[model samples]
Target: MATPAHLNRVALRGRGARSNATGRFETYRSESFDDGWTEADEAARPLTTIIQPMKSRTIIARNDSPDIGFNASINPYRGCEHGCIYCYARPAHAYLGLSPGLDFESRLFFKPEAGRLLERELSKPGYKPQVIHIGGDTDPYQPQEKSLRVTRAVIETLARFSHPFTIITKSALITRDLDVLGPLGKAGLVRAAVSVTTLDRKLARSMEPRAATPERRIDAIRQLAAAGVPVTVMFAPSIPSLNDHEMEAVLQRAAEAGATSAGYVALRLPLEIGDLFQHWLRTDHPDRAKRVMSLVRQMRGGAVNNSEWGQRMTGEGPVAEVMNQRFLIARRKSGLDAPSQRMDVGSFKVPARAGDQLTLF
Candidate 1:
């Protein structure tokens, strides 16, 4: 899908429908022509919907990185249905022989057994609990989750075992598991972070087409906070020229919406994401595309991305420093710099094996 040529004149509306594919999720684009009108039939050219399928195994994925918070994580599904053009995980689909463009959002994978596998792993005698991050690599609450409920099952298992975990997502669907997350938060076993890239509904639609509307995401934050869930707002992958300007506004709104803490990451276009994001910028925001790339290069030491551990997340140079400073100031002003309450791992309760029941006295 090409970025609209008149992005400056474009005003986004949240009226588009979801995709209809069997195994993936999608949101169709709704365009209004230059004449300031959209025909009735033109309003519904494409129908987007979520698709899902089951997977055989799901368990722990280990990553040793100084930059990331959690060393271990779990993804209930592969290929997020959110269809964010700037997603850093898009390249992953290439390994599956899928296009990082529309195909990435249209093709999906699910690990239905994730909850069972997590139980088995947590039950092992040698298993030690550390905060397990969900939606670390791909969103746990992508659209397909509505049907598969794999993510909810994982949360249920974690709740059952009192395992500590964190979920980061852009979808309001996270609200659906409030039954599980609410109590877990009270027990200090869970925290949830909602990603808000841009507050502008139009920008959000073009940038993260398949995720929930910005208003809905804020509502999710409010609901989580009301339920006693410690909620954090994440302005992740802050594309320099495109959405960077909204940093302070996003943080402020999140604070108003009950976000206690907030964080932001500079856009990192690693591997295929570089090409994919460039394609998106050119297609959607042509006027600012060059400037955006220039600023990204300035931050990345004259490259579109830097893969080094410490430098990758924040990047380098004047542009990055300015972004960091802006975020720090905004975060401090909004009273969002306070540390989040840590999830407790000591309270884990391991379930017994199937045949281990003892006779009642």
Candidate 2:
């Protein structure tokens, strides 16, 4: 399928989405008109990322999805800058009245008071500590995090309260917090998961434009494991006929690098994500796009997506089963098939807040 002319705008370098269509909630639609003179200037200039602080009353978000591993998660940022074209979280940007395409990656929001909000929540009388996942929707350590340190602050708060937490990220920036994570990891209070989609440099650069390279992710697993942090390598969104062939290789490399656990999630194309990913595939990999979508549909039951609870994470059908078996066998061979490390919930305790009466111990 050829990309529609209106949606075939030149993809900006370092950005994943080729077009910035309007959000689904908007009533008006905007398109570009070529007067024949400005296209050159537009192509010459690069798009810049804009970030604004978001005022939020709460920090911890609780979800009761049975398939999800954790009941609560904290995202320090609203939008991710890594610009992974197949990110399942893209649809969330629509709720913000922004396009799930380019706007989901370039225009971002951060919660400057995440640490304070979390502390207040933890200090509450009825608050109960559970395994908290970081970066469940968007990457907590996206590029902006290097300077903002919002994720660092959240980690600090969790550590201070002796809460058990797990973090999933594709950025190597998580290594900078080894000072905190290393100790918490030793106490069984923290674990980490790194998503490594493909080993091919070119493919990773195209699909997850701004995330860490495959080598760096593997190295991150090594670093985390070395620091006593239990590391799990997530081979997520395993696209058919594209990066699927490298599943075994990626897992083998991660295990060699010291990853003790591993997991995978089939590609998900829900809502606006279906169109955005299709656009990216048609524009970047037109040659194999048809075959790719065909395999995806086969797994998705004749559609590009199947959001059913039991099947959304790993799809269904013969192809999906084959992928699952392959992952199981490969993980067994690589010694990553062991049960995952359990976080220590028993050690959780709320730290004393300032201005509170001192204990008479």
Candidate 3:
């Protein structure tokens, strides 16, 4: 991996990745150099966020990964603007022949016709009403979601058909759609999960630059629970030395704020994410970067990451076993050890669209 250039300071401010290296399949790599002619603070500008429409033929994606919770998922957006450094979804951007570093966050794509496409798919004659997870690959309520409202549209379509769904996000922006979520919750048709990595504001700001603050995320849980939503607090990507110590505290706070259940996932750095995260760790937290990586390897069986089934989400060995024990104890103490409520799939019905013939009973 290339060193983060000084230009990164100006151009990639508030972003997680330290360097924007080319994707793995690219033909050639590029690096930055500073010539003596350029003056300091001379017309250097931050990179602008570019938004584009993604022309996707289908909306729902199916997976057979046994480790994953849901089989069917939908993503309204192609990339996330939250810029979380430990995001496992980062490597997916490489499929578009784009850098998983800065480009993954800055250059984003949204499906403008997501609501229409979902309606058509749900209207299929043999369509089965199963639990569809939203924001499975990328956050549905990223920063741009506030203005684009693509996520809200999809939710409306789901509501019309009485489809069961679940959504997970780290953004406070989700609270803005309580009007839709409140009714879904009442019908047991929807559940929400908020990802609260840590209670320390500073650490969260550095690790997940554009995401909601820890305090705001806690507040979002409070609001969702108050609105009758069955909310789950997710302490995801639990980095061993850096944020592992805060897991119990995070669950406690969420439980107090009305979270019904809690879950966690160990840090996963697959593909290019390994390089991007290491670069950020060295640049931002040089004090404990070495120690953090050492602890991670101990959990991942002497490697930085492991992709084996059943052991990937929650690693193995002594360190990981200890963490799991701690989480179980904490979950019990926090009163969040109960299983989540199952969504109502039998209530699903195909909503009539405009210009359709009325049926007489």
Candidate 4:
């Protein structure tokens, strides 16, 4: 099969994805290599990931699909730095005329005006409060967040408005914002989910190169729960024959760490993700690639992915069914679904506008 040209490069230096394959927007191709380079010199060459900032007029992205739970979501960054191999958001990079492979990881874009835009949106007339999902497309707390803090700014705006919201991330960096989240949690306006794909550190290191380790995520869960924040453990993109077997163990750990609720998403490979994932499996776990793909195809109903709304997350078929059952059993046994902590939208206060006189209802 003709796939993305693999970039034979070292795994270090914050680089992850397998290739910088041409995206859907591009009509031409671009390739780079040394003219007089020998195989030996390739190993010693140095490369670095680049960050490009972009201004976004809008901060909230609205979604109406029944499969999704939130009406509005905020993506502080366009591409994720965590570099998860099975990320469904990878294909979105194509829209920016960039590759959905390595470029999705190395070439990043953060919206610096997210907080201002969010405040402006919230100030709109008749704006109804709903729990806005943060990091719906990319990890808001991705490595870039350490300096950018756009996600933090957005959270600050939400907190000021007493807006209801939820955060989803696999980075322990979220712990840095516990001061803000703690107050919001106490106000019943916030909750969070930590995506823990697998407990195997080695597999996690290979698949989600820059994400928080499994243990640290669990620790983050513990910290959040201790701070009175509702922590939902998300076992996302559970790859069959790879890390699916650890579903119970992972949930158990989360529950022990005080996660009150849990959720799981069967691996979703849409568009270029299928090819990129296949290539990743071949390079990292060659022996299991064929079996994993076979099982994924079966779950996807003979295709690499099924875009139908409801089926996209959990998937359908025997393999998917078994995995779903396993997750449910683990959830209940772990007491993760005991009682859902609901965020309050009724208390939502409209944010302050640039120039407005205060009025009481």
Predicted model with the maximum TM-score: 3
- What's model 2's lDDT at 136? 97
Residue 78: error of model 3 in Å?
1.4
| Model 1, global lDDT | 0.79
Q: Estimated TM-score per prediction?
A: 0.85, 0.96, 0.97, 0.94
Clash pairs of candidate 4? Answer: 19-102
Clashes per candidate (backbone, < 3 Å): 7, 0, 0, 1
lDDT of 1 by residue, 133-157 (tens): 9988789988778878899889999
TM-score of 4: 0.94
Give the Cα-based TM-score of candidate 1 against the true structure.
0.85
By TM-score rank, best first, the candidates go 3, 2, 4, 1
Query: How displaced is residue 227 in candidate 1, in Å?
Result: 0.3
Highest lDDT, which number?
3
Candidate 3 residues lying further than 4 Å off, grouped into runs, are 4-6, 37-43
Q: Which residues of candidate 4, in runs, are more than 4 Å off?
A: 1-6, 9-14, 30-43, 351-361
- Per-residue lDDT of model 3, residues 177-199, tens digit only: 99999989989999999999999
Total residue pair clashes for candidate 3: 0
Two-way TM-score contest, 1 vs 4, winner = 4
